[model samples]
Target: MNIDFTLEKYKTLCETISNSSYTTFTFEQYFNQENPPKNCILLRHDVDRNISNAHKMAMIEQRLNLVSTYYCRTTERVFKPEYFQEIAAMGHEIGYHYETLDKAKGDVEEAIKIFGQELNAFREFINIKTVCMHGNPFSPWLNSNIWNKYDFRDFGIIGEPYLSLDYKDVIYLTDTGRTWADKNIRVKDVIKDKDHQKNNLLIGNISTTDDIINLIKEEQYPRICLLAHPDRWHGHLIDWTGELILQNLKNIGKAGIIWYRKNKN
Candidate 1:
């Protein structure tokens, strides 16, 4: 099989979706639509680390006339105002990929406060209508937990995928752990919808970008939210190879952590 996580494959995947019967929409567009199209794709990118990679993906999608939502973390390195503005200018939605709880060290009040600050900061670049949690695997705290004490809706946010979207309606597929089938390394990216699991929907059935394209061609699901991390898809040989090596090391560490937690419980 050819290399799957390359920019060529990524562009092919986008082209497949673009050529399909399904219409692609940004998360904000999908959420605001009174009557969404029957077969649709909500293309979302979680900009966890590399802003440049996210920008590249955004440009590709824009050239294809496809819009996607990009959730950016407010870390010093990842939060680039110019890049965010560029993505928004390309007609992509910009959202906050918040990890305030972990940053707050599990203080709910502090987390909520920090979240507001970060959200406001991001707004200076683009109008952020949605927010997504950044699951810090090493932290004991889940960033989504901040909502348990305070609602994001209060902050003018319309949606948070993990909290807002019904998995029963939209099939959630994420490239966590570098492969769609590997659930062990995923910390908070999994969906908890029982119906989705019982039906054996798209979870374990997909492994590569090609698998996703085939499924779309078959019209396997009514709607899908394809979550991709830009850092994983690189065109340059050195950068791509480096990411592969780094992810492998990270995966081993994540596996160890998962095993320790399972055994402890």
Candidate 2:
């Protein structure tokens, strides 16, 4: 039971809202609607693998009687046309997972050009509307990695949640570097104002898996969107927990190196 907690935690969170008998459902069916049900689980998947971990997460959500949105990168390493049709077949919303700034690597102008090109490529297979940043931690820019280079709304995009949400009001949760709320690196999907700035783009951070469960228990907010990487949640306990632990370790080590170099100078 102790060993099973990590795997059980995410599953339990899914089951609680889906259960209905134990807890009632509270999610608005549309975006930006006032009087939202309470907690809307926007299960997001960022794909970079040839085979999608997002697909597996979608399957788990299906078991819980839920659906989610998946954002796949159009880069050579992550591109797969056949899988697009299959994922769309599963009834999940398909989106573009973009890392244009990283693609440009400090050239904001080139990043914009590449973003438009990538956007064009993604539309070839699926009807994509929403987008989420790939969270390229090493990049100096966050959402601006792509958006700062260009206006996504001009491309017919409805909303890019990472940029659109004010984190102060909506609680922001992500599986970046495979941990819950990490303090060291730059997180791309930060819509929250942690300083308690009201009227700004607000998003709260959930530091632990237990925090997520407790929120469901307490019925904290009216709207919440969880950003998860398909690469993080592969469904199997060994793989999921292993990835989370290993990735966070890598991030910690990277932070140590940066700190050492900064102080050495």
Candidate 3:
């Protein structure tokens, strides 16, 4: 069996969503609505590095008549205002993938100030109602921790998945470390409840895109939050192979880090 992260596979995933009873929603739409459908899939894209890949994914979703939320990082490589505008013009929600805590070197005040500035800058492209933390895996500071000292609601942000979404109610799945069910390599892009996940039989069963499509076909979970990094999904064979090699190297490094953290404690 061969499984590759290509545009075709992504389209298959979207088709599965279309065929199922699950209603697709952007993060803003999911939070703002008073009473959304019980069975819904919250599709989110975190544009960590590649801007073009993000646009491709957004176009794919738009072609399926699906509106998903895209979080853009304000990095030199990923921050493209025109791309953000293009994606937002397709009726997708645009948001900030913030890394202010890491950028500010754990300074809460500085992080908050930077956050405000970046949020305002992003609003110039689209009305951003939600923000998500960009997990700087190698950094000592967690971006989500900034909320402990300050509130996002004060900034007119409606929701942050790590803070607002309850894992008990919604099953969270992220394509971190280039694969699903590889939580050991994930730094901060994971649900907090490990015990609950272990108890849930369907939690670790899905590993690939096909696994997720099958789950959707089976109607396994009523509510699912699918988090995808567009940089990992590529159309070209060379690019796909390169990403796989790079992610494998990163996975080994992350595994070592996890081991060190456990033994040190």
TM-scores, one per candidate: 0.95, 0.77, 0.95
On a 0 to 100 scale, what is the lDDT of residue 1 in model 3? Answer: 36
Kindly provide the TM-score of model 1 when superposed on the true structure, using C-alpha atoms: 0.95
1 or 2, greater by lDDT? 1
Put down candidate 3 lDDT per residue, 1-265, tens digits, no spaces.
3555887788889888887888899899989888655799999999989989989988988888888998999988988899989998998998899999999999999999999999998887678899999987788889999999899999999999888876676877778998876558987776767644753455556678888888779886778888889988998889999999999999898888888888996
lDDT of 2 by residue, 70-118 (tens): 7777777667877777767776777787787777776778877888888
Q: How many backbone clashes can be found in candidate 1?
A: 0
Candidate 2: residue 58 Cα off by (Å): 0.7
lDDT of 3: 0.86
Specify the poorest-scoring 10-residue window by lDDT in model 3.
195-204
- Which regions of candidate 3 deviate over 4 angstroms? 194-201
- Arranged by lDDT, best first: 3, 1, 2
Q: Each candidate's lDDT (Cα)? A: 0.85, 0.62, 0.86
